[model samples]
Target: MPVAECGRPASPLIVVLSGPGGAGKGTIARMLVEADGSLRLSRSWTSRERRADDPDDAYVFVDRAAFEVRRADDGFIEWNLFLGCYYGTPVPDPADDRVLLLEIDVAGGRQVLDRHADALCVFVDAPSDAELYRRLVGRGDGADRAA
Candidate 1:
């Protein structure tokens, strides 16, 4: 292991940002990583289709079968099934020295905490319920799902 400025062994800081959909978790995570070169946002893999407005690097889009195969192979550090879609975070490389940022949901946060007790978890929320619903619907989620 590498030593820090104080000479103690260095380890990556796992930071988890979790919240309901349309709560701006992704936006916050992106800003944090862009502002700090040492913070790396781990790209999540999803079985859901990528939205048209989603950035090219938003996620590692994959088919359900491929996602299932990866899950069976223990490729994910945390995984969840939401609204008929599978979402998971791949295990970060052990050699990576940068801090890791995970944008996930409540259930995934629990799983990460179970494995990494030292992780810092932040819960993000929208300014209001109305705003959250509006954001969700604007992002193409059905009204029922947004509600």
Candidate 2:
């Protein structure tokens, strides 16, 4: 509720885009950031191995130990362990001065909501289970993991 000298809200609006795997959350997040000059996507950190097809900037890749160390230091706004890998959204830099966009899962969204009650949360879902599986496999995820 803080106000800036320019008469705007001091804190950037927090937007949480969450969904199950293969639900197009990443694509939508990218589109939203691209279309809005005042919005910035906060890249997430992950301990999982980067896939060959993944964009270089998709995540701030790190080893599990490093991820744990950051978690211990309270560097993440929300962090979660999924399928034996760790993923987290880092706390926004105060100087960024833009609306913050978070692309994460439901659990992470819940954590963010617990801390920032006013965050705008959007849940994306695939049109059908079969299509979700197809998207997952097409994206290089193993069938077992996709399921």
CA-only RMSD, every prediction: 3.1, 3.5
lDDT of each: 0.90, 0.90
Candidate 2 accuracy as TM-score: 0.93
Candidate 2, residue 115: lDDT: 88
Q: Which regions of candidate 1 fall more than 4 Å away from where they truly are? A: 1-9
- Residue-by-residue lDDT tens digits, candidate 1, 20-139: 999999999998887777789999999998899989999999999999999999999999999999999999999998888999999999999999888889999999999999999999
Quote each prediction's TM-score.
0.92, 0.93
Candidate 2 backbone collisions, by pair: none
Clashes of each: 0, 0
lDDT by residue for model 2 (1-147), tens = 221222445687788999997899999989877777778899999999999999999999999999999999999999999999999999999988888899999999999999888788999999999999999999999898888
Model 2 misplacement above 4 A: 1-8
Cα lDDT for residue 147, model 1? 85
